[model samples]
Target chain A: MKITILGCYAATPRSFTNPTSQVLEIKNHLFLIDCGEGTQVQLRRNKIKFSKIKHIFISHLHGDHFYGLVGLVSTFRLLNRENELHIYGPKGIKEIITLQLKLANSWTNFPLIFHELTSKQPELLFEDSKLSVSTLPLKHRVYTNGFLFKEKAGDRKLLIDKAEEYNIDFSLFKSLKKGKDVVSEDGKLIPNRLVTADPPPPKSYAFCSDTVFDLELVPMIKNTTVLYHESTFLEDQRELAFPTKHSTAKEAATIAKEAGVEKLILGHYSTRYENIELFRTEASDIFQNIILADDGEEITVE
Target chain B: MKITILGCYAATPRSFTNPTSQVLEIKNHLFLIDCGEGTQVQLRRNKIKFSKIKHIFISHLHGDHFYGLVGLVSTFRLLNRENELHIYGPKGIKEIITLQLKLANSWTNFPLIFHELTSKQPELLFEDSKLSVSTLPLKHRVYTNGFLFKEKAGDRKLLIDKAEEYNIDFSLFKSLKKGKDVVSEDGKLIPNRLVTADPPPPKSYAFCSDTVFDLELVPMIKNTTVLYHESTFLEDQRELAFPTKHSTAKEAATIAKEAGVEKLILGHYSTRYENIELFRTEASDIFQNIILADDGEEITVE
Candidate 1:
């Protein structure tokens, strides 16, 4: 799985820095997460195909999180997109988008499906043959949800030579790969392990942002292959973190340590601090495997 | 009067090109005209102060024209702007903006005043001591209005020496500047014209975009100092221009010639054209004093 950070700044987009937005490439899905203003331009700069973005997940309704959504949608229509675009966000997202389209008198030719999230509890957002995505409820200034992208272990690989040598029929390979013992032609039960090897372990990724440090979320995101958490402030501004509903680097580290994620990626830095080294130093104290997320940085998870 | 082009491309903002947005500096007012997406970054890159933009005028509901508005508003709030902001646009603009703010729970700390325009006829939108602004209704795909920024003639340049020689009271100077005849201390009537000269002929500017060639608007913007008209297509695409409700370079020049503007500035070029020189060539064919507007180009309306 690979994650590309399109923007990692907080509050506003600047000349060089952009607001929050990213692209997660996992299991044949290129999911766009939290499109802030100027996201289309960022996508163009990063050379990502606009048509590849089939699903967009917005964590919250803040302007910094979803302002670019309508523009991206309009751009899709302009590009003559034929595929249905699925958008998952808060309850009022559909209203906010459809209203703009109504005023412009330009409706998308493609099917625009909206799955507005209102539940505060974890809910299944999207599921496919290869992967599943669920919401990780977060504490923020408004209604917010972080996404969990988990790859489902594929069907066990079939050892054709091993099965053939055991005089197994090709039709029994399907059941053997599904971890079921194959019935022989003479009514002898053959062990599935003898014919098929185990599949690669399932890998999962978790994204959390615009939220204060909440210990309750640790259980849901525990043992994730990779975890991206917003560390808007450093340890110096730890006192302001909770009030503003943003995590400090130390707070983010504590959560990462508690969750036992393989890699803790800290991002969504406030523009006030020029040097982010301090954040790295602070979070490194707790979580040794930490990656500082910046715009245009791509991280791969095994 | 000075005008700065923040963005001038048509359709959508790309990696280097931006959509419609400009700054009209008439007298002391720095009025923002047509805020497209990524306008805030454009403002920063152009070195324009955010505080100077107290007023923003949106032409229509097109995503390319007003998508950046909400983000700009949120940025203003984040910057702790204290001055009230006035936004003048179509009737539904208020609802569109307020809804987003309500969802984010981030109503601006500064008062946001919305002047929704529904009239098809020209109407005065803003007025101060030195400048008066009005709307120029145009034909487009949506309910749109082009803005006319006109400088009100300043108090006739007071000829201090001429007034003193006429033995006119300083208190009566105000009346004389108002182009009224004033009686001197010796009961001599001083002609206002004899004492004062015209105030630079009252420079004016008109901005029109995403519009078709409309002769009805010529009378309202007649003899204006400078005119910036959208030329989304060249002569080759003239046939397509009318259908799209956009003007060609030649069509824009026709309007400028009919309106008798001092200088014609052509902009809002479709991204399909690689070279903008063709726009200048086509426009200059009809009008001699033609200025091709490009991003970051500055023009002084004398």
Candidate 2:
């Protein structure tokens, strides 16, 4: 899995900086997250194929998070996209989009699907043969949710040498890979473990953002391979984070540490700070493995 | 009056080229026209004070014309604007904006006034002591209107020497400036024209965009100081322009000639062309004075 940070700054989009938006590429899917204003232009600048974006996930209704949605939808129409587009966002998203389209009289010719989320608990959002996604409820000034994406466990790898020695037929190898015993031509049973090895462990990534310092998400995101969390402020401004329902670098690192994630990626820094090195420094003190998220940066999940 | 072209290109906002939007500075007022996507960023880059934009006029319901409006409005709220904001657009604009505000649950603390335009004919929209704005109906793919801003005729320059020579009291000076004959203290009538030179002729600017080449607007915008017309394509693409409800450079120049405007400013160039000099050359064939509007270019109205 690979993740590209199109934009990661908090609040308003500046001439040099952008707001929240990212592209998570898992398996065959290129999922867009939190489309802020000018996200389409960022996508163009980043050279991301617009048609590759089939699914979009919006965290909340904040203008900084989803203001670019309507424009993106219109752009898709202008590009003559015919594939279905799925949007998963907080409730009221459908109304906002529908009203804008109606006013413009430019509804998409392609099918635009909406999945309005209002659940307060962690609920499964999407699942396929390769990957599964679920929501992690977050505490913010408004209704918000973070996403957790995990690669599904695959079939065991068959030991070709052992299978040949056991006289296992090529057709029976499928059952052996499924951890099933295979019967030879002589009607003798061959144990699955003797002919196959366990497949590599599935990788998982969890995204957290626009939330206050709370440990409630730790259990849901435990043992994640890569954990991307919002670190809006530094440790010195922890007090200011409370009322705004934002997290400091130290707090985000604490969550990463408590969850036992392999690596912690920090982003969504407030524009008030001239530089974001302080966030990384503070987070690094708490969590040794830290990756700073920046626009145009791409991180590959191992 | 100063006109700042924040965005002048047509179609979607690209990485370098922006869509339609401009800032018209008339006296103390800063009026924004046709806010497309990424306009807020353009405003920030241009160093235009956000608070100074109290009134906004949207020409049509096309996404390129009005998509940036909601984001700008939300940005104003985030900036904690105390001044009232007045938006004038198509009839459905209010619903589109109000629904988004409701979905975000982000109501502005300041007053947000919406003036929805539905008139098919030209009508007055805004007026102050110094200037007035009216709509000039335009033909487009959707319901659209162009704006005409004219500086109200100023008071006649007070000639102190002539007033004193005519024994005109200070009280009559106001009447003389009003182009009224003043009765002197000697009971003799002093003609105001003889005492005072004519005030500078009122300057007018007409803005027309997203419209086809129609001669009906000639009488309305006749003999204007500066006329801005959309030149989305060059003469080579004139055949394509009619179906798209857009004008070519030659067509826009023709309108300027028929209107007898002093200066013609051409904008809204389609992104398909690599160079815009061809547009200037094509327009110059019909009109002598042509100003090509580019992003960040400012034209002073005399």
Candidate 3:
């Protein structure tokens, strides 16, 4: 999976910085996450194809997270898009978008689907043959949710050298890959473990933003391949984090450490800080593998 | 009054161009008009004080006209604005803005007042001691209105030379300046014209956007000091103007000529045309004084 950071600033969008927005490409799907005010312009500047965005996931209804949604939908209509579009966001999102369309008298010609999430519990929001998505309940000032994308387990790989030495029946290879004991022509059982090796590790990615320090999420996001977490403040101002329902870099790294994630990517820096280096230096003390997410940076998870 | 153009492109926001948004500064008031996406960034780039904008006026519900409103309001709240804000827009605008704020649960401490105008006839939406604003009906695909900002007539200019020559009484000077005849203490009637001269021409600015060839507005905006009318297309694409409800350069000039405005400014150009010199030449054929409004350009109406 490849994730691209279009913007990472918190609160307001500045001339040199932008608000929250990102693009995650898993398998053949391009999922847009959060869509701040200038996301479309950032997309254009990054040379990303606009039509490739078929699904959008909004963490909450905050203007910083979803202000670009209405304009993007309208631009799709203006560009004569005919493909069906799916939007997954908090409740009341559809109403706001529809009201604008009604007043403008410019509804979309294509199918526009919306999945309003009002639940406070962790629930499965979307699933397909290749990947599955579930919500991670987050603690924030408003109704908010983080997302976890995990690849489905695939067929097991065969240890060709061992299988050949054991003279395993070639026709029974499929059954062995499915973790089934195959019967040889002589009516003897061949254990699946002797023929097939364990499947490759499934890749998983977690996205968390606009949330307070909540350790309960560690279990749900255990052993994630890559974690993108919000680091709105530093340890110096940790006192203000809980009251605002935001997280500090140290707290974000603590969560990543508890979850045992392979890599931690921190973003969503507050505009008050001139440099983001403090976030990396601070977060690195808790989690060894840490990287600062800059606008236009792309991270690939194997 | 000083007017700053933020975005003027007719279509979508691109890396090189932007959509519709402008700032009209009259005295201490910073009146924002038509806030398209990326307007906040443009405001930052131009070094305009966002805190001074206490009022926002939208011409229509088109995405290009008001998509940036939610983000701007959110930024204001994030900055902890203490002043009340007023928005004058078409009917249903309040519903959209309020719904988003409700969903986000991020209400502003300042009052957000909305003046929804649904009248087809001209109406006064805002007024103060120095200025009065009224809507000018326009033709478009959606419900639309143009804004006309006129400075209230100032105290009549005192003809100091004439007053001294005629030995006018200082106490009667106020009544004479108000265009009233005064009776002298000796029972002599003196015409007010002898003591006072007409006030400096009250400056007026008329803004018309996304409108078709509608000559009915000429009488309403007749003799305005500055008129900004949409010239979305050139003379070559005039055939497509009627269906789109947009005016060509020549048509905008014709209206400017019939209205006899002191100066005409053309903007909101379609992105299809690279060169805008054609609009100037075409408009100059009918109107001698025409200025092309580009992004960040300032127009001072005196």
- Residue-level lDDT of model 1, residues A188-211, one tens digit each, is 788988888989888998999989
Global local distance difference test of model 1: 0.92
- Candidate 2 residue-wise lDDT, A15-41, digit = tens: 988889999998889999999989999
Candidate number with the higher lDDT (1 or 2)? 1
Error of 3 at A76 (Å): 0.9
Clashing pairs in 1: none
lDDT per residue, candidate 1, B1-302, as tens digits? Answer: 89999999998999989999999887888999999999999999999999989999999999889999999999999999999999999999999999999999999999999999999989999898888899999999999999998887777877989999999999998898888999998899999987888877889899998799889878989999899999999989888998899999999999999999999899999999999999989888789898888888889865
Best by the lDDT measure: 1
C-alpha lDDT of residue B129 in model 1: 85
On residues A41-153, what C-alpha lDDT tens digit does candidate 3 reach at each position? 88999888889999899998888888988988998898899999999988888898898988889999989999999898888978988898888888888889999999888
- Predictions ranked by lDDT, top down? 1, 2, 3
Return the DockQ of model 2: 0.72
| Candidate achieving the largest DockQ | 1
User: Against the true structure, what is model 3's DockQ?
Assistant: 0.73
The model with the greatest TM-score is: 1
Ten-residue segment with the worst summed lDDT in candidate 3 chain B? B160-169
**TM-scores across all candidates?**
0.95, 0.94, 0.92
